[model samples]
Target: MKKEIGSEFWTVEQTAEKQHLFNAFKRNQRFFLSGRTALDFLIKNIKAKKPIRKAYLPSYCCHSMIQPFLDNDIEVIFYEVLIKENKLMIKVDPNVECDLFYTIQYFGFVDEQLDDFIRKIKQQGKLIVEDATHSLFTAKAFHTEADYVFASLRKWTGLPGGALVWSNETLYAPASKTDSNKAYIEKREAAYRLKRRYIEGEPIEKKAFLTLFDEAEQMLDKDYRGYGCGQEIQEQIEHLDIAKIKKNRQENAAFLCEKLRFCKDIELLYKAVKQDTCPVFVPIIVKKHQRDPLRAFLIQQNIYCPIHWPISPMHKLNVGTEALYKNTLSLVCDQRYEIEDMTSIVNAIIQFFERK
Candidate 1:
């Protein structure tokens, strides 16, 4: 199936947790646990043990990833993506006074600053959960003893559900009482059927429909009601092929980076810095306003290309939405695409802008 692994939803053919995310959809009847969303669970796990009032956030990221806390009325502070090579940058929220702060290892680079930041926060008796949805495999979610951690399984493992993984056992998270996860199961089947259809050429209206197969069932995360982060697509994040998937993704990323290095239009996406390897998604900043025209051209050629984000972080806080899209685009460069596909995408991109 044409994987939309870029948007944090994946096939959960492996485990029950994965199925919960995919099939459960938003009708979270299953673990009506004490905490609702992943962020809530994270908050409860905070060392304070009291209500988590505040935390840090990636200026540019999937808003839904942090929605649960906001839905439950937790404070979310904003931080900018530092160009300072792997070091996380932050500015405190006004009048919000939150001890807890969180940061993401974007592109999965687990830099020294990330560790130092966490240590500094924990020293003050706060919390930091490494949001590893994007960089799960690259940076070990459980690597450092950050109070709590969570990964969007679908992003890397391609599972459906996303939640917290706590290191300190003292943290609190009540066990869910809700039984019989019918909704989650149903969504899983829906995803599976969608995949089967796309694979069998089952009459999709457009190739774009393929990406929505997993995204359609996402739950609106309430954390961003203040600014509108988005809903979590608690789809089936299951069936982690581990070694094979990692190998495929890493190889694909390396291949593209090497071959497309000279492509004038496609700017280098992320710094490939993982020591182990196995990367799948590749992002790029396009050179011109040719996103629509170029994308349309690629589509006509039966080449499926898509942008990754909706809004830039600069615009998230009403700071500066001007650079919202600029040249930012995320094209599918996973294991599914072969060398020929990469070549086609690269040549098409270069040719499109080269003509300009």
Candidate 2:
């Protein structure tokens, strides 16, 4: 028997109340189609206010992280993030003055040191745009002092699409455009149908539904017609329970850690979980040779783990980041999983290494 802890679809009844979720955002908050769209909105508006020649971005970030800045004709300067002696270290050029800086609260784990670093950058009079994509369910999401903060909400909720951009100070968003989310809705529906067929042992229906899902993805990739989130996604967020989501993820992560801590072959990336942090996933590091084998074993058991990001040529020379990219595995521990699922996942990993 196999159980999957990720990839969820929601019915209308599962949606949350709008007022409850919308109330979380202040008057200055605005929604966008996606995080990249929000980033584009922020950069365009910020440039309109002041000249932005150079923007400091994280070197160990995804390519999409730098795309918006480049699209805005802003110079992109990469800064280094190193993991030294089990502690995260970040370095930036003090002499290089930038109009803005972009960074993230990686994996929802924020410490006093990270706070201090952000403050230090603030002291340098640089406009900071913090990406809270992974930290949306954490306490730091609400308490950040950054000039602009945004996140892709689709990652956390059962919504087809949504992202939010907010600032303590007033910032203008791009004009909105209306478009249909028919493709997005269909994609989710197809996924649900596919799963049902799989459970019923109907191979023919399963294949048909899978093809429907693929077609939906292709349509979505070609369709970026809307400027902001659709009404459906907005309604979904309204009904969601943020606190419970955070609690479930935290408990599930702790449960998995407790079960797997004694395994010698796996190294937990961050052993100590902070009370304030809402973990998105439990990350582990393995020998380079064991990485693919372990990933394959989990896949065979219907346990899906993701690589945080692919390593690029730039990362190859940076020993710390290169090692992390090559060996790190992010185990899904989102709010969807319970103790039983976490235990099953842990047992699967232990069995894999035991046979190795």
Candidate 3:
């Protein structure tokens, strides 16, 4: 094989264990499954009628994540993020009285601020449905007082499916008996397998992944039930020693942060709060003009930094918030990467700036 930049990074937790855990702990008051896990407390359980004024969303989230409420005939309101600010506190529309709110642990850093947001939403008698897809197994994950929480094992753990978790003392209504989407589940499993192999210094073609994605997309068009869906793939979402993952990523991040602090042109998005967060990824928000060039330079050197939440302007509401959308590109920090990997990334970035 030709000399290749070895792709080892974070490894995922086991799948079978996560699925078994899901099956055994179906103790939420009433749960539903779908493309994304949703806790429709009103629908899942018997709750008093609270007219949903609108559904509030953080502008930085994926549309598919917010689709559950939209599909259920609710209006959507967006929460603006102060991306330019130091702490990046989220700004909500106080006037928009909502019956439900979509809270995301953005890159797994939803600490005390999350609680403050939740308290405000709960006062309005609205359900705070948290997307734990990114912030799995953190201190807040297992022991949370949040009304509803759901996580996809694929994001952080080595699992094929997701879990719809809620209060341990709650019950759920069974739906989506037709899980013909097993093929998609299988594809997800296979994709992870191939991706892991390639990440482990094994060769994998980019085309192979694109082909799998196409196949999965076809299945969704044909076999998808409305909401609350899954395959019969049972598994547990497991993680490597999270403490070790956190330590490694932090060490790598700190080294890069030191290197990046002096770069007059590149804007670091958020400060690394290591102990408080199990950061899902690392991102550096750059000036709109600087983003592409910086990404290009890094890619040329095989650094492979990626962009997160690149906007799709399909939603009319996505327009006004464009100013708040800081152009961000990410550097990998999963435990699979060593500090030396980060040093190389910093060197590539330094060379790029020096060339300019």
Candidate 4:
């Protein structure tokens, strides 16, 4: 049988190369248990310096991205993100009152229009914070003029818990000690090990790892405290081949864009991969009625794709934004897979539509 195409990453084996991943950063940086914790640390630091009354955020975002601001008593005002002719456009009024502005590099593709919007707001003395979770591998990840930048490393690699918060200027020390969620980390580590064994043809049941992953995710959700990176996870980061990973992701994403161009009932969010982009996922917008069905069908073929997000009911989104959320699906095109793997993904997606 063919190996599963996509899901959670498996743990990386110890390698002789010690590239020192953090050394690439020219700014002061701190590690955290997850992206949310990193963002929380930044939020508290900003609050300590000044009163943040209101912040502008993109409508297409995960709840974790918004929770840190809300926890600090900051009001969140979401701006619209619309797609036309397969390009993403930002709609925000310059006259809106906001103390802070948050931006994202969606799916590792830089939106030039959003950058211009950020520049316009920055000129007005609005504090800027960028979430680089999806764009960590891209060249634009740390080149921002934002006051703070943070990314969750776990999304891109096989680490139990890893994230980084950085700034061009000195960052204030975290107020609290890093969280010691031993159970959560241990469960995720176990899941990674089991997944590696399963991929290597071990006589293991898939449910074993899946259950552990779910438990770990639940534990993480319940705990909102900030955490520092553990020693072991840091060591693993040092061994990563950052350049190779970026190259693989770019090639795979480019291949998918070409292969999926003619797919019926599916629209590629990005028509071409930019020179500097290292895509986290090759996102596509499906017909609203077929999105869930296509996702279910892919899972049956041992290919797992994730929805970009499921917005909370608390944020009453407009009809256009709501439709975008419902129809969008993030396809796996990370470093884990190569051309052959991506071809399989394309074929599976084609098969799904042909059956309809």
Model 4: per-residue Cα lDDT over 1-356, one tens digit each? 33888889995534578976655667788888888888888888788888899999989899888888887888999999866665566787766899988889899987777767777888898888989888888877744678888899888878898888888766787537655467889999999999888999999899999999999988987885666778788777777778877888999999999999888688998888988998899999886469899999999988999997887864658987777788888989877778999998899889988887
Error of 4 at 259 (Å): 0.8
What lDDT does each candidate get? 0.50, 0.71, 0.58, 0.83
Error of 3 at 9 (Å): 8.1
Which pairs of residues clash in candidate 4, taking residues 3 or more apart in a chain or in different chains? Answer: none
Off by over 4 Å in 3: 1-35, 38-53, 111-114, 142-145, 178-180, 196-204, 217-234, 238-244, 313-320, 324-326
Instruction: Assess the local accuracy of residue 303 in candidate 2 as a C-alpha lDDT between 0 and 100.
Output: 82
Top lDDT hit: 4
Q: Estimate each model's TM-score.
A: 0.72, 0.86, 0.78, 0.94
Query: TM-score for model 1?
Result: 0.72
Q: After superposition, how far is residue 281 of candidate 3 from its true place, in Å?
A: 0.9
Report backbone clashes per prediction.
26, 6, 24, 0
lDDT of 3 by residue, 1-356 (tens): 22222232223533222333333334462223333544343334324334555677787776566555555667777777655453455777544777667777767655566676677667776767667766664445532445666665445444444445555444444444434346776776676667666556677885675577568656654544434444433323332355566676667766777778777666666565456566666667675467788877776776766565656642433444554444677777666668778778878777877787
Scored against the true structure, residue 344 in model 2 reaches a CA lDDT of: 77
Between prediction 2 and prediction 4, the one with superior lDDT is 4
Model 1: how far residue 20 lies from native, Å: 19
lDDT of 2 by residue, 1-356 (tens): 12455544332224334446544656377777777777878887788788999988877676656767777888888777765654455676644678887878777777455566677778888888989898877776633558888888767755656787888767664435654355665676667656655655655444665576667556654554346776767666667777777788899888877777777887777785677778888887775359888989988887878887876543323676566667778888877678888887898888998896
- Can you give the lDDT of residue 50 in candidate 3? 48
Candidate 1: where are CA atoms >4 Å away?
1-36, 82-97, 111-113, 142-145, 157-164, 171-181, 202-239, 273-275, 303-308, 312-315, 318-326
lDDT of 1 at 100: 62
